[model samples]
Target: MTATAELVVDAGRRIAQDHPESPLAIAGLTVRYGDKPVLFGVDYATPPGAMLAIIGPNGAGKSTLIKAALGIVPKVTGEVTLFGRPQAQERHRIAYVPQRAGVDWDFPATVLDVVLMGLYREMGLWRFTGARHRKTALDCLERVGMRNFADRQIGQLSGGQQQRVFLARALAQDAELYVMDEPFAGVDAATERAIITVLKELNARGKTIICVHHDLATVAEYFTHVLIVNMHKIAEGPVAEAFTEANLQAAYGGRLSGAQVTRLAGASS
Candidate 1:
């Protein structure tokens, strides 16, 4: 791709190649804060039914990439696609679970109330929360083992419990694609296992999941695809293909040894 093309993804002018059927396709996405660029010409596509992990060292813009693609942040240039269509056109089909630390847990909302908010896409904000909607929200909460906490104040819950409630909210969305920012961060072991089990079950049901993950040791066990970045595209593909030492070295600046890489992502070489 040319320098000019790197700033935009004009289908006719830029690279002819694109992941036409991908659940999420980031075409040369870039973001900058002041003069310091947070992302540089990142191009990647999420495979259908893929549990993809976005891995990088701190400050590599992993969260920014997700935010930019989802319109949470401003992008210098680039285009995003969803299910072969423009992002805005297909955004309703996707659900996002932001980082737990970013939430305002002190708000006076109940656990069930949070999950009920997910129904706004289907039932408008003005629509009445009928028995059916309540049932759906309760069902989602039950899926994450939070049914008992339905009426509990969000601020009173533990960190892991709070995370579970958010996952239940995402489940209530009933979306085809799930984008999560560090669902496992700061959670206890039991919570981690529960979240992964729910994620795996969702993946088996053909949901495409894109998660910004920091724990390298869990990459191989949790995801089928990986995207490694460092303010730019480094490597991205199936775990075996993109999680190798050479690629991680390129992203982490050679601080990671071959043995470490192999153990981290279960890479062959």
Candidate 2:
């Protein structure tokens, strides 16, 4: 690792020890596809009850960072912890909502069936879905305004409706920390508002949410903290402090167009 990478890793360790109550901590995270590295030593820690936005340009490894932390993709080197424990030990406390495009919407399953899958971790491998599980799933759907579509097939819903279904499933998990990737991408305005409202409610309840968000316009409005990355950790902290024009420039490498910057400034204002 380079000296900068070493420093980033060391800083992560210190932050983790100092803020031992953090819901998520990642150190020296590196991932490679074939011989090419996607993420070079990256480190980050999410403050308790924070709504953190992980943002960067296309191919910046934003999604890879989340996937590596969750062990969905193999990492070259890294340490990931949840609530001061190894992620494996605290898996039940974490909920993941992958990007919509990453899923096959045509899968033949009812909305209720998909939501009920979230309870499998609590139900154990041998237990079957029962009345209580069904009720919980229904309630989660209701929370996302999808209760009426519980019987609908997953492929039959619109993009926004599908996003709601995914969110409801995550709610059903009832995890303390939520890691979502591009939940707002391709969604209707109403769906976006609904997701924000639900996320705010979760934050109010002390649940930590970390989203790999693409929309620069909504970062300040929706998230409490921001993690800017372009192959490595560029900057991370409370949105007001860490997310700035300079940091955005550094992370985007001059690709953030003038209009986008203007919109970002307007949004943050």
Report every candidate's CA lDDT. 0.88, 0.89
Off by over 4 Å in 1: 1-7, 11-17, 254-259, 265-269
Best by lDDT: 2
Clashes of each: 0, 0
TM-score of each: 0.93, 0.93
Per-residue alpha-carbon lDDT of candidate 1 for residues 1-269, written as tens digits (9 for 90 to 100): 47676446664223214567788888778899898999987888788999999999899999999999999999988878788787788888999999999978999999999999888877865678899989999999989999999999999999999999999999998999999999999999999999999999999999999999998888888999999999988999998888887788778876777778657655332
What value of lDDT does candidate 2 attain over all alpha carbons? 0.89
Tens digits of per-residue lDDT for model 2, 174-235 = 99999999999999999999999999999999999999999888899999999999998899
Q: How many clashing residue pairs are found in candidate 1?
A: 0
The TM-score that candidate 2 achieves is 0.93
Q: Which pairs, if any, clash in model 1?
A: none
